[model samples]
Target: MWHDKSVAFRLVRKKDVQETGELEAQARVDRRTKNLTKRLQPGNIAVINHSDIDRVSAEALVECKPRAVLNAAKSTSGRYPNLGPGILETAGIPLIDDLGPEIMDIREGDILHIEDARVYRGDELIAEGTVQTEETIAASQEAARAGMSVQLKAFATNTMEYVEREQDLIFDGVGVPDVKTNFEGRHVLVVVRGYRYKEDLAALRPYIREYKPIMIGVDGGADAILEEGFQLDMIVGDMDSVSDKALTSGAEIIVHAYRDGRAPGRKRVQDLGVEHVVFPVTGTSEDVAMLLADDKGAQLIVAVGTHNTLIEFLDKGRSGMASTFLTRLAIGGKLIDAKGVSQLYRSRISNWQIFFLVVAGCVAIVAALAATATGHALFGLISTWFGDIVHWFATLF
Candidate 1:
């Protein structure tokens, strides 16, 4: 009877196997890829609704080490050469694109399995999409390069419109509110969540330690500064990207209430009971931070993770990239980029500092001499002897 029961259990196990999946893993879904990545674990599938995914976003995903990425929307829509799809492919992570909106319906923590392009829940197929490989991503990027001219033309038009409307703001520094942080004659480092920010910040650690500049983190960049073990002096951005801990980290918060960023930006800060200054600007928060630094007399502004190349703006898909040019023009030569500055100049104990230390020590000797009358008589005698020697030396010459 025990042998018969064992055979029945085996049959039941076999039946369940046919109904279940071979490559089962939990699903982590979010419409916003950035928010999802915060809790995304290794060996878990990431379901996102990102379209034309940019490089920075892709880099964030790769860092999370997800098993597979399922995009509900197209990863590359031939708009421009977006680097996210290729980055995921090169990292050896399975990227299934255009899985349709139904993939988002998969409950969070649901045990899911992926086979080829298809995603399944037990025996039922949930969603299917085109699997991205190296060849497909390369072809898509090549095709996307052709769209750059169109993007450029649009960028120029947007830039021109911005200049016409915000001429007073950029040149006159209008609407840049005063901050509690004293930036006068001090080096200010403004960090943004763009380009190679992680590496740039790593490079600037020496500079940061030596200069002890006022640290201003723009949005997610605030988290970057805290991660580096430095106190964040200021955070300039809409309230969406930064952590609540950063808001309460004693850094003066400046909320960028841009055209559409006004209401939601203010409310989030209010909910968190974070006291903030609302500066309504027309351009990006990074630009606004630079302008504020320039207006408040920052001696040298070192920028990190900012857009320095044309391809970068395109990669981020920002049409208002011309604002970057305008902001630089407004700040003149005082603002310098920190991307390669670390490689160019490593901070060290300089000769000037040593010289100043010696000078400080000499001050005491001078003070001691001035306090005694005998010191004055000795100075006079030494001067007469030195004058006679100078006269004899002149006769010999």
Candidate 2:
């Protein structure tokens, strides 16, 4: 009976469980969004502690192309409708919001698996957080827009405070530092790394080529100038985010120091052995650039990428934009936004356009000649010469 017994064959297959599990990706974490973005690579998840992330920072993050963003703090804290989170979310990058300080426990370069609102490390659950979907972000943005009045009131209050404190420097330029760079009786172009800066610069190409204004780049704007194949006449900033290439680009450097005589960026410039002058004052580097240009007696100051709106000032997340508000007031008639200038001034006709115009004029002249009796004789002679040349070529062939 045992020898006659045949073994029944059966087959079993394992389910594909991993396919439906949490999304697994590596992470790059930093308390500072700027610093984190430097090391962020495509497909790496970004964990940041930035609150009310600005548009510039969001654009930087989007450029890195991360798989997802995990924020330890609020991306938009209803602070005047910041464009950062919306920018990230619209780019199709998933955002896990308000993960709390516990999320920081995840080390840089650690593998993470995210599902729903939970972040896990292998089999162990690490943290639970709110995932920012389009609807949630839109609601937050709407709330922020509603809160704009409060922000505006606060901004106005701050501007008045700054104006009262720094009123003397506004008019008399008593505390402004003297530099070797002369802006007297010449146009000065002050460039900042604000919204649509590259586009504004492109639009100003003809103006830059023609007027040849004294080019002053504020921090990273110096790199932008260098990128556009233009010479940097002077670079004015705190010297935090600019590149070494820009530092060595033969432009005059001015280190913006604090009012207490503490210049954090000075040592970096000094260590690089680049010649620079220290402008010790209050307010932002942009404020300093405008004051410098104004004090140096610039005939006109054209600003590129400078923050002009309430949202822009808020996006900077600095109360010191009060200085910018005052700076604009101080330099009133002389200062104009690049956008305004670009609109007002017509660009000179390009060389190619001139060439085409010349060609068209020659063709018109030829047609005019063809309509006249002298032209008929000239055409006949030219035809005879062409026929002789064709005959010669035909005989040679």
CA-lDDT, candidates in order: 0.83, 0.84
Q: Which residue pairs overlap in candidate 1's backbone?
A: none
Query: Which structure among the candidates has the greatest lDDT?
Result: 2
Model 1 lDDT tens row, 1-397? 0001111101011212322223457889999988998899877888999989888888889998877788999999998888898788777677889999999999999877677678887778999898787777888999999988998888889889999978888888776787899999999999998867877898888888999999999999999999989889999987788899989898999988765445467888888888889888777788889999988989999999888676777766667778887888878899888775546666687999989989988998877876899888887889999999999999998
Stretch of 10 with least lDDT, candidate 2: 1-10
| 239-341 per-residue lDDT for model 2 (tens digits) | 9888999998889999998878899999999999999999887788998999989988999999998988888899988888878988998999999888444
Query: Number of clashing pairs, model 2?
Result: 0
RMSD of 1: 15.8
- The TM-score measured for candidate 2 stands at 0.79
